[model samples]
Target: MRKHRRIIAAFLLTAVAVGAVNTPAAASPAIDRGALLAQHPLTTYESGAEVGSALTAAGFHTPSSRYGVSLHQLVYRTVDAHGRPTAASGLLVLPRTGDRHLRTVSFGHGTSVYRGDAPSVAPDDMFLSGPAITFASTGFAAVAPDYLGLGAGAGPHPWMDVPTETSASLDLLRAARTFVARQGRTLDREVYAAGFSQGASAALGLARALQGGADPWFRPAAVAPISGAYAMRRVEIPAVFTPEVTPKLGAAYMAYLLSSYDRLHDIYRDPRDVFAAGYTGMGELFDASHPGPEVIAGVPDSVGELLTPRGRELLLHPNARFAAALREADSVCEWQPAVPVRLYVSPGDEQAVTGNATACRSSFAARGARVPAVDVGVDRSFSGMVHEGAELLAVPRIAEWFSALAGSH
Candidate 1:
């Protein structure tokens, strides 16, 4: 197991080394969104057994891998939060099979404060890359977007902004389709969408876009999102002030959210307007350079301690543009999905409470979409956090569901 892990790590490091020296290509005037700008070979698993071993060593449940997988880091054109064209990066994993036509799955990744933690850049970080690799080794071409500003993309990540998340995901699909075509593989129109944490919301957003005909070619076949803060205004924001969530976790999330919103919506004229005296520099912590641990360390213990009195009031009873932004971000589940959808959650999740998923199901039901929020159960292991554990338990089941759906189609 150690040897298999070493092989994976070495190859990933080598890919980064190779990618570092390559100069980015000049932007084309007529280049469309999702246009492939650059591609770097990352790593390859020789067989299904090797793929399974690598994943097992990384702490994921042993999955059935039918084929070897090859991974590539793709720098593609995508729009940033401001609607201007920018270069964003993602991972494109392909199954080593004789088939020329491939079913596709797009996996939106969980939250990461640092850019280096992105899947395309850190394939060995199972939390980010595992699902994409799992889908690829199981015969689906997996596209994992690093999202705007989180990979090699050029801006501060827009945190929970769902529009950019959907756009980054949609454009990555377009880029992946083009990349696969160059290798003589044609992607099917049906895209199986899945994600975890912040990404779960992204997956739902992507599904809504695809179902609503945001893209001319691709349509969502099925969606399975795990432990997302889908109903931010109704469930997530309220939970942060309660004892249900840990103070550190809640503060960190609040800091990230406000800073990101401030960038996109001008939520505050300055950080001091929102943050408390000591924590006023909170916005600088989420600039896509600092590590998550650093951000957590920089903040006060609780959301109440971190925010000013006015700031706390704004979050509790948001008004004006802040209210509108939260409303927009929280609306991912408001539409009725035409495809089969499942919301995976753990009742013990300390960060994003399971109530978020419950709220999402209620919203979906109101829209006549009877989506099920499946409990993947809590991770009881000594070393596991419930939030991370839920994802570990959920990915394999989601992969199995996607495979069955792909086969049926």
Candidate 2:
């Protein structure tokens, strides 16, 4: 265990050194979209065995690995939630292969409250880096965007904001393409989009953007989002008040969502207007710098204790800007996509209910699109809870599905 800890420390040190040495100079007058600001070498797996061992250590299922993997932390330029220019960071994992042209997988990550837990910032975090590493080790270039305000990005994260998630993710793909080009390698135009939980919604949004020609070079080939809260207003919000969601978990999610939405949509004039007197300063805990556990501990167990009655009513029956924001965020599946999509879910998931995936599929069908919701089943043995266990099982399936699609095409 001591040796393992030393190896991780070495990787972190190497990343810091590389980033310090390769940091880009000051930006010019014009902002370059998708510009690679800095690249840091994180770690490398020399063989499939090493990749499997790493996955096992990270508490994720071991997928069939093909090539070794090289992971890097990439700081790139992207627009913030408000459409202002900003810098964001993410993980770029490349497979060690002889092929000059590589297929790409863009993974949207689950919700992260603390900046330190981001994939680029904490590559050893299984939940953050597992999907990206899995895809890369299986021979695809994996790009996992940390989204705005998380990782090395500036400002508080606009959590659950689909537009920023889509923008950040698309920009990372652009940055990855640019980085790979310099190494005599090129990315395939077809991109396989996948994400877990909050990232699952992001993956759907990104696929929509890619289909809508968000980028000139890359296009989404297939989308597979696992355990995502796709229907926020209808399914997700209502579930928060039910027995399905524990009070503590629901309170934390509501706190993060309300605080983030307030930043983008001006949902509340004052913290007191939304939060209960005892929890008036709850929003401040979600400033991205606070540790997630600390933030959770600071808030009350139940949403009722966390919010004012008006605030609770507003969430239950939202109106005005808050309602509009929910509509926008919930509209991820409103548009029809030209590419195939599969929504993965676990029926036992307490946080993001399985209803979300079903609701998303219904929305897609309403738009004359056929999308399937696949159940990854529940893992009783895994201690990360049903939500995370769902992701653990779903990633390998997503990789296999993506590989098959690539093979067919």
Candidate 3:
């Protein structure tokens, strides 16, 4: 049992480490949810100069005053999967020199295993902060959600669960609007949504919700989801069963999704039912209490090796509940977008599988939605091109895309 445990943990950790390099997780202290249910700011960076100082201190370059930016950390009320009211945190960045009515861009972050990687706590974590900063520098309001259970929120992060991710992100955008107004600022009613990897799926979910009339107050201007995992069951799930996946990445994401889904859907009666003997007791590894690379070091290679026989069976052919979760998470691209939409893919992206974007584009085209798929030019293989290329190349471009749309509208 101990030997199996060692192997399972190591392999899972390795899978996560590989994926973590491409996307991103963390642990956090407990907080009182009751007091923070009203959706308010926990802290604020008073001026662009103050933000600049903080950025400089954090080893980030301070941009010129094209549009000076300020930051705020918010704790807002949202619902869990069951519609139970819960608290989540996020960062709201506003441009100081914008026309009183600032255009908004909701930037969803990629997969992060650390709580500190959240924009509210560590905006510099995902290369995401740079884009948020860019949005602000370009005179846009950037709302970056910490998502539930991360940052100052209590309990486990929901990982890639679509409903929670959508709700958390939308609620943050709502909270940001209120936060802005309370401070004598105005926001343009429309929002440009964008993200990468897990975040890309999240952004699309928000766009779907907004287009579906979940929130009429905020119209969709444009959406850019770069290298999102839209077709998990089709592309990602099958790939994990083969060596095409890195053991570290498979372990990391599986542990994250399974553990998170267990919270929302009660998929596991006991951790031992799904996990190998070695990893049954280590549920805290993905609870945001630890970094992903450290967690990956402890997991073995391959999701199949990390799962029990029954667990492996479920992975290959999911039951109703499991299938439902995947279906829901993967349904981001199914809905039509009323606004302009661009699906960014990388030819080199192994983590997100470019096919997901292509399939998504096809869905949009079939539905007569104004959607176009762009392949960003990253041709490297697994280690370099597939994972980090989108973050390094696509994010800044996404900001520019958002800027153009915002300027036009």
* TM-scores of all candidate predictions against the true structure: 0.92, 0.93, 0.82
RMSD of each candidate relative to the true structure: 4.2, 4.1, 8.7
Q: Write model 2 residue lDDT over 150-206, tens digit each, in one string.
A: 777766888999999999999899899999998999999999999998999899899
lDDT of each: 0.83, 0.83, 0.69
TM-score: model 1 vs. ground truth: 0.92
Which regions of candidate 3 deviate over 4 angstroms? 1-65, 379-385
lDDT-wise, the better of 2 and 3 is: 2
Clashes of each: 0, 0, 35
lDDT per residue, candidate 1, 1-409, as tens digits? 0001111323233334224423333443454788887888888999999999888876677578888999998887777676666778889999999999998999988888877778887776776788899999889999999988777766588999999999999999999999999998899899999998989989999999999999999999999999999888889899999988877789989998888888888877778878999888877888987766666678888998999888888788886888899998889999988899999998878888999988899999999989988888887351356787777788888999998988887
> Which residue pairs show collisions in model 2?
none
- Residue 210 in model 2: shift from native, Å? 0.7
> Could you tell me which residue pairs clash in candidate 1?
none
